[model samples]
Target: MEDEAPVIYGLEFQARALAAQAGETDQIRFIVGTQSLRQENQVHHIDFDDENNVINKNVFMHREGEMWHISASTVDKSLLTTCYNKTSESKAEMRAALWRLPGDFDDVQSEDQSSHQSLSLVCHLDATDYGDMKSVMWHPTGDNSNVVGLADNHIVVWDIDTSGNSAQMTSSAGLESKGQPKLTCSSWDPHHNCVQIATANDTFIRGWDLRTMQQTYVIENAHGQLVRDVDFNPNKQYYIVSCGDDCKVKFWDIRNVGEPLKVLSDHSHWVWSVRYNRFHDQLVLSSSSDSRVILNNIVSLSSEPYGNLIENDEDDDDDADDRESREASPPQDGVIATYEEHEDSVYTVDWSTADPWVFASLSYDGRLVINRVPRAEKYKILL
Candidate 1:
């Protein structure tokens, strides 16, 4: 007989973007949004163990604004918090703040067991230049000195290290098509040597090389409807994945931008976000407006051995048949799991960088759920 595998635990919250600490696998953080009646928003940090027990919990930030987007710094374990105050029907102000863990912070226990310390505000910038900020991201490399923000019709880059008082917007890029709808989402390309960004606007995904301050590549009508989110594969340089209002996920190779490498249509409603598993190259997760989170296995669909047909000189007719067979083969995406716990539309889903099995999902109804991938090996042993 074999012992039972450990059962994973989940914690729920009222938040938007849930980010795991850079080097700490057990630490997770997120920010709550302001309610329509002007209730205050907050940032939360939680520490959990392998068995899903909550070790420590703290409120990192408490303020009077709505957090539109939040990103955790990969290099320094800090957080980039972006928020806005809607003053009137058509007037709003946006701000970005950097928060860091205090030096005397303890993962074990504090002298005051009843009190928890808040995260220290390193610096913050308030600007009226960019209104209605939609997304924010930290540069993957360069010691995380650079941050990017996307707003109505422009993108702004900030230099946190060089600026003495607070992070300053160093440069700005305006959308080529000015009158179109504001940018929907933006992602930093992890594999590019320099700073390269991919942004979704309406039905197109545009790639920008920040080094040259130019648009490098653009995919026209990347989706049937408005593109919601775009993410690049961390393992492969030119590979990208995007989700859109059409309830479809599309994959693209930047080198060949004419068509998507594959299109995955599984979600029944608008797919809001898509993420690639950091540890497993084959796994991708998406959250949709249908109140479900889906896990997809795309290794067979994207790998060359399964997607491409072999050619042989011995049989010309066989080679032609093989080509036809390859063209007729459907996408090899398999839905391994579906999570339907959230009562509202799930807006965000993120995978933990340190833990392979742990992930988090958040919904518009102020519900957040932490989940673990079910493993059969943990439950049974083969004899």
Candidate 2:
């Protein structure tokens, strides 16, 4: 069995330090994909010092066959400046400055979505129209060029053109059904030609046709509590998984509106985020307030137990052998493994497009843990 170790690509943290007589100062540091998990581990520290005169937030990365880049942002009352580090030295310097400015600045998350090319989309959370910028998803076509943003109260589409500009293609308002409010998490359907968009609110998962801007389907009471996260499998678009404050992860078949295909109730607390692995439709990664990351196997349609899940289980003595056979069959899907690394609530978890086994987790404590998805083996007993 050949398994590739996980990649620790980037890390962001807050670090606080106290000087002899200078008092305290807080600074943010980001370590890029330079050192391996053992050496430097791509972890950065963030913090604010006592002086409060200057605020420093920096982004650092050492790319393969390339020079290191460290970006810095300093805050002062109403002014903010961003500059890049261009020196062999790791500390802030004068000659290595790349750019400077005066304006409001927000933290930029790591961007490299895949090994081929990196993609990034930014939203003004405090801006009037965008409001909160709740969720974001990349176009499912694997183009990595376009993005669809679900904001405070709007659905905005950005088409990445050749000139390096994201053109806003469309924006839609909210719905007032049973006080369901507006969209929170939106995704481009993976099974189709990016023609359908699915969004979740406090109570419903609604589907809309991109061509007609009409509701195609709606699953009400999708989650008993506030639907916190929803995601479409990159490989299985018709199927989606949603987790909520209700403390349940439900799998749904968009075509079958009545009920979820399966309900995976393992997390002890609210499920905050869920995502499908780019490499395998059967593999999924989910994070929860329980401080654990769960790896699940989504049963394929080809599996017999899948179809029978929504079917009645009625067996007579004459069919005893058949029932035994069915009992011996493997599960529709099973828990592959669980990574209990984060000490606090894990807020976000993402799979590496470059490596299938590689995944990363971010927690409320600001600790980022990157590791490989371990493989599981089954043991059998003969009678």
Estimate, for each residue in 133-153, the C-alpha lDDT of model 2 and write its tens digit. Answer: 444444544344444556544
What are the TM-scores, per candidate, against the unseen true structure? Answer: 0.81, 0.61
lDDT of 1 by residue, 1-383 (tens): 43223222233334565656654544443333323335545555555454543435455434536666667676665454555454557855656666665532354245554554555676764445766676668777645577888877778887885335478778888887847578999989988574799999999899998876689999999999999998888877788899999999998999899998888888999999999877665678899999999888786533333433344447566667677775577345578778887877788888776677767777876676676665642121110
Error of 1 at 359 (Å): 0.6
Q: Against the true structure, what is every candidate's RMSD?
A: 6.6, 14.6
Q: Can you give the lDDT of residue 134 in candidate 2?
A: 46
Q: Tell me how far the alpha carbon of residue 217 in candidate 2 is from the true structure, in angstroms, after superposition.
A: 0.7
Q: Which RMSD does model 1 reach against the true structure?
A: 6.6
Name the runs in model 2 displaced over 4 angstroms: 1-127, 142-146, 162-166, 178-180, 300-332, 377-383
Superposed Cα deviation of residue 71, candidate 2 (Å): 19
In TM-score terms, candidate 1 sits at 0.81
Model 1 lDDT, residue 368, Cα: 64
Q: Whose lDDT is greatest here?
A: 1
